[model samples]
Structure formats: structure tokens, C-alpha cells
Target: MEKHSTLAQPDTLASAHRTFATEIAALQALDARLDDSFEQAVAMMLACQGRVVVTGIGKSGHIAKKIAATLASTGTPAFFMHGAEAIHGDLGMLTRQDIVLALSYSGAAHELLTVLSVVRRLGARLIALTGHAQSELARNADLHLDAHVAQEACPLNLAPTASTTAALVLGDALAVACLEARGFSREDFARSHPGGALGRRLLTRVRDVMRQGEALPIVHLDTPVADALVEMSTKGMGMTIVIDDNKQPAGIFTDGDLRRLIARHGDIRPLTVATGMTPGPKTIAPDALAVEAATVMDAGRLNQMLVVDDTGLLLGALHMHDLLAAKVI
Candidate 1:
């Protein structure tokens, strides 16, 4: 285990405040320094027919990896190529159609310089993110993004603190600009991040989560209220879908409807499902997103919704519980 200093609370807080202030100032400076160069970089990325290969060494390498992931998830094809690894066998991954995004605070990492030389020889475009525009890496690049910082957030000003943050933010700006330029949508982003929560919500369809076939609670308008209740119980959806003679959804009978029916008529055995069913209930298409179903249910203050086809034929049923179980809520 590492030993920690028994520092006072106020001193620790003061140190944190100073670090935040310094980093904020650095970001403000970067924001003010944005120019047409940033737009040109975005244009290069948008026009590239191949992937964006981000390369860096040390702390910048970590930032580069994150930037690559952000770009990839946001509809841009990108991957990280470590600077040191590029000088080895990884340079083979680059193609003349691809663009190289190099990060180096000092703009003089030996590994990055070697990769830069290979990138130039292959006729690939280069975008350098560095603190010094006069450095070799920035000077040789087709476009240089000035990620200059007045000082590091570190108290000693020795670590790559503010500089790395600026580079990461600049890379993100480029990725977002490219994404908007390409008209990337939420569906596109979900396709790239299928394992994430947003992907589950955006990609999952009503058919994917709604109870269907035997699991669906369905009945006719003439079905007895008692039998409809049995179907609801068996399906565990707290509701039963009422269909017409043509097999189209007519309405829905839910637990709340049953309660209201009981309140209105003491002798419930005489009532048919049609008497208690809510006609013209809000419905969603089977191919619509599960999140859309959730939105409809929420807006109507309903606990259940019926899924139908384009012709209004009953396809399935969705309960709020189904949305919760599918983690789409």
C-alpha cells in the first residue's frame, strides 16, 4: 500500500482549488485562440476516405486513445496507434487515404517523429496537436492545432496537465464537428455502441421487448371481464388487448380499468370486456424503438400499450414492467 500524507483538510482543498483555477484558465486561453485552423482540421477529417489514426506517447497517448474512442463512437472511423508501436510494426496499419492525428506537448517525441516521417512518405495528411507551433512535429504537419497552455495545473508545472486536457478537448471538438458535418444521428451512434445503455434504449424495438404470441394477453370484445382478467394474470402484463373481428386492436383493458368497472357496477359478472375496455388506446408500431414506447406510455399516463402493424393488426403488448426488465426505461 502507498503511504499518504496526513495533510489538513483546508490545505488539501486549497490545492484542489488552485489546480482547478489553473486548468480553467488554460482552457479559456485555448477557447479564445480557436481560429480557421480548427475548421481546416475538421474539413480534412470529414473529407478523409479512410480512418483517423491517433498517435501519441506518455500521457498524451492515453488522451489519444480516449479521443479515438470518442470519434469511433460518434460515427467517425478511428483507432489509436501508440507512437512507440508505430515505429515498430504498427506503421503498417496506416494507408495513404488515412489521416494521422499526432499529440505531443513538446512536439519532439522521438517515436512520434519517426511515425510522422513514415506518414509523410506514405502521402498521408497529418494534424499535429502540440503546445509549441514552432516545434518540428507541428512545422512539418499539413495542419497544426495550437494546443498551447500558459502553465500546467500541477503545482510544480512539470506534469502534462493543462496541455493534455487542451489536446483532448480539441480532438473532441474535431470529432463532433465531423459528426455534425456527416449528419450522424442517434441511430448511427447506437450502432457503434451496441453494448452501452444508450444503444440498448435506441436500438431495441417494440417487437424486441413486447410480449408476443402465447405470451400476449389477447381477447375479443365479447370476452368476459373475468376471462380477460385471467389472460392478464397469465400473461403477467397487467392488461389484455381487445381485438375486433378483423383481428385488429380495438382497445385495451387494464387492471385500472377493472378497478373502475368494479367501482361503477357491483355485479361485475354481467359486464363484458367491451364495457370496461378503453377504446382507441394509444398504440405504437412493432418496429418503433422501445424508448419511444416508454415515451408514449409516460405521456398518456398508461401502464400498458399495444403494438400493432401498419394495418392496425394486433402484434404484441408492452407493459411498463417490460420496459424496465429490458432496461430500456
Candidate 2:
């Protein structure tokens, strides 16, 4: 349990809210400044045949890592390189075809500049995100984005706050611009992320894992009730497809149907498969994505789905457990 302190508030509390609003306002202003340089940065990345190498120092390094992740997820291959490590042995990660995106609030990070000469000699183009256009980093960069801010969120006006926000917004702007110009599709995005919820929604198709052939627990509509139960138990899918003499699905019989029949009629051996079966069970298309199948299954228990073509001929059946095991959910 927390000991609630009943302390009187100071006048500075109101000023703190004002500070947050002010920083947010700075971000809005920076959003409006997203222009050609943002497009140029995207173009530079699109033209590169090699990976994008991102480098920064201090708090800017954290922002740089996030920007790199956004780029990688959006179809641009990118990775962050520590500024100091580049002086050690990580500079070998850079190729001449790659582009360097450097971040420094003051447009000058001592460690980032350590390899500036080598990067230039290797003919790699530089795109810098910084506040000072005249600072060393900006002057040396091939393209510079102006992420200037009038004040910091800190009361002392020294800590990086509005500046960091501006840089983050600018990085997002660049990545999205590139994402659009490259015609990055949802399928492509899913290909890069086969682990995320969005990826599961886009990539997993039904045919990829649906149970087909003899694996489907099925029986003729006129098959004995005793035989149908045996088939369902053998397949372990909790249901069986009811097909007619023409080999077309007539209906379905599930554990629920059996329970209801036992409750209503109290049958011992008089009923047959057609007597208690549910005709025209819910079905799904083979081309449907696993995500869509999940939705159908979620609507109810949907133990199994009958896959069919346009003409409605039975193709196969799929189980909800199959989808779960495949990690399609």
C-alpha cells in the first residue's frame, strides 16, 4: 500500500504542464517543416544498394536506434552503429554504396567526427539531422535537416527535450517518405515482420497449413451414427463432415449436435448420421488467409471448416488447433 502524502501543490506544477504543451507545440511546428530535404533523404536511401548505417552520440543515439528500427520495419534495411565503436573496428560495416545518417543535437559529436574523414574518402553521402546549420556536422554533411527548437523542456533550458522531439519527428518523416516512394506494400511489410500481429494478419494463408486429404474426419450422410462417432474420435477434430453418395458435403455433425440430440431424444441406437446432423455447416475458402479463418473460428468454437472452390465442391477441412499450432494466431 502506498502512503498517500497530503502535501500542498506548488505554483510550479502549472508551469510543468505548460512546459509539456510547449514541447508538443514545438513538435507540431517541426512537423510542418518536413519538406524536400526529407524527400532527398529518402531518395538517397532508395538509391543505395547496401544497408543504411545510422550513427549518433548521447541521447541522440537512442533516437537513432529507434529511427533505424522504423526504417528496417518499413522495407529499408538499416542498422545503428555506435559513434565510438566506429573508431574501434565497426567501421568495416560501412560499404561505399551505403548512406550514413548521423544525429547530433549541436551538429557536432566528437566521436561521430572521428571517422568523418574516412567516410568522405570512401565517397559515402552524408545526411545529417541537427539544430545548427553552421555547426561542423551540418557543414560537412551532404544534406542537413533543420530540427531547430526555440527552447528546451527543461526549466534550466539546457537539457535536450524539444530538440529530441523534433529529430524523432524528422526521422519518421524521412522513413515514411521512403516507404511511400518505394511502393512498399502490406505484403512486403509482412515479409519483413513474420512475428508481429500485423504480420500474422497479412502473411498467413489458409492453404499454407489447412488439413487436407484423408486427414479430414469425414463420413457419408447415411453412415451409421456409431461409425461417425468412431471416425470423429479417430481424427480427434471433435467433428465430422457429412458427405452424400455423390461425394458432396451434405452437412456436418459435431460434439454439440450429439449432446443436444442425447438431451432432446435420449436415443440409444435408433438414430443414424443424417438423423442428428446439421446440414450446410459453416465453410471457408481455400484461398482465405489464416487470419480470416481465425475470425470465423472465433465467431464460435468452429472446430473445423470445409474448404471449397467457387463452385462449392468440397476441397478439404481445417481445424482450429492446426492454426494455433502453426502460430497463425
Candidate 3:
């Protein structure tokens, strides 16, 4: 049988909570430590003529990679390089126009020192995220951000728990601040992340996926319910848009309406679309996002909607299946 620690489950839970509390306090310290230097760092990055190169080792390296990705997606162009690899031939990637962001919990990472020297020689400005403001990396940096924490969340204070969290949050702060400074919009982010769901939401317009031209099931308001049903059946969209003499949307008729009409009178053939159809049906513009169409369908308990122009002229129609096929669902 395996032996267990004397700590009970409640004690373990308490320890976990204390760990979270300690890290939260460390982040609070970092928040209070934000100063003019952070502004200067942002300015330096904004003025860079080329890409930002972020480098770190170990846990800091993981944080650096995420920071680089966030910066790239948000607006600023950046890439991550291992500090040790940077000292190798990767140093050739640096140029006079680039800026270096070096992350180190201890201000004296030996691997980073070699890279920092080359960066200085290359005329690239260096920004240091270090715990000690007076350490060698901080002293050499053109902009030094103090990422110091009072203690590690680790019980023994040996592992880099609280310290790494502070660094990661500080990096996120910088990325978001730069994003706002650049006036980057969702469209810009979508362009960067074209393969993701958010990209689909921002990049897809209603007209791109809506059934238009001959595919739209449209009929005159005076048309018989039988004729409307034929149009709906031919289009296979479960609905037909009823238009007035001016060629503008007057109303709509759907499969549900047909079933309800049968339930009420058992005779839909005698009715005209103008008398049996729903008046003033909900419609959407072609330039709107497909997600907005999904929202309307979900809210109104509808299966499809008519796409109209500003003057209420029918331009297209979209079914729930269309949205599902487009992955907008």
C-alpha cells in the first residue's frame, strides 16, 4: 500500500486556496509597481522600425512565447527565440531596427547576457522584465520593468509559481495596452486568426452565404397559398417571401404556417398569401455578420429569414442549414 501525507483533504484545499491568494497579492504588487518605465517601454516598441524579438529561458520562455503570440495577433509583430539559442547563430536574426524583450525572474540569466550584449552592439533597444530592478540585466536595459514578487506561491519558496504568474500577467498588460494604442479592431484580429471561430464571426458577411438571385423563394402577395407552397417546396428552404406589387417584402409564409392553417380550417388552397401570410416579417441586411442572423433565428424561434435592402426590397434569403454549413451556428 502507498503511504499518504498526514495532510487531510480539507488541508490540501486550504493550501490550494492560499496558493491562489499569494499569487493574487503578487499580481497586486506588480500593478502597484507600474511606473513611467512601462510607458517608455511601450513607446520604444511603438517606435521600432522592425519586429519585436522576445527571449527567455525555462518557465519565462513559455510566458515569452505566449506574449509574442498575443502581440502578433493583436497588432504588433513579434516572435519568440530561446535565450540560449539566441546566443548561438540565431543572433544573426537580430538587426539594428529590432527591439529585444528579455524575460528573467532573476536579473542575471547567463544565457541572456550573451544575447543582450549582441543586441546592444546591433543598436537594438533592450527591455528587461526582471525581479531585481538593480540587477545586471536591468542596469543594461534601455527600459526595465520591475516584475518583483514578495514570495513564491510554492510552500518552500523554491519553485517559480507566483513569480511566473506576475510575469505572464505583466506581459498581457503590455500586449493589450499596445493593442489599444494601435486602435486595432476585431476585423484586424480576424485577419490574423482566419482559421478560428472568432475569425469566421468577424470576416463573414450575410450576403456571402445567403441564398440570392434565383435561389430565393419569392412570390407576389396576391399569389395563392398553393402557389407559395409550390415555391417553398421548389426552393427547399421551408419558407417563401411574399412581396408587394412594388417588389418589396410584404410578409412571409412558412411550413409552420401551413400546418397551423390546416389545423384551423383544413383548407389552405382557398386562401391568398396576402390573407394567410405573416405581415412585416423580420429581415436582415446583406452586410451584417452571419452570427447576427444566428442570433435572430435563435431568439425568434425561426428556421430562416429574408434578406432585404434598406428599402425592404427582397435581395436574398438564408436558412438555418446555411448557417450550419457555414459554421456560423
The sequence of per-residue lDDT tens digits that candidate 2 reaches over residues 131-235 is 998989889988888898888888788988888888888888778888998899999998998988778778888888788787888899778778899999998
lDDT of 3 by residue, 60-126 (tens): 9999999999889999989999988888788898889988999998989998988888987888889
Residue 136 error, candidate 3, Å: 2.9
The count of residue-pair clashes in candidate 3 stands at: 0
For model 2, what is the alpha-carbon lDDT of residue 55? Answer: 86
What are the Cα lDDT values of the candidates?
0.91, 0.85, 0.89
Candidate 2: lDDT of 42?
A: 81
Q: lDDT, candidate 2, residue 279?
A: 92
Leading candidate by lDDT: 1
lDDT of 2: 0.85
Model 3 bad stretches (over 4 Å): 1-10, 185-199, 219-230, 243-250, 260-275, 295-301, 311-313, 324-329
Ranking by lDDT: 1, 3, 2
Per-model TM values vs. the true structure: 0.85, 0.85, 0.82
Report the Cα lDDT for residue 216, model 2. Answer: 86
Off by over 4 Å in 1: 1-10, 224-226, 257-276
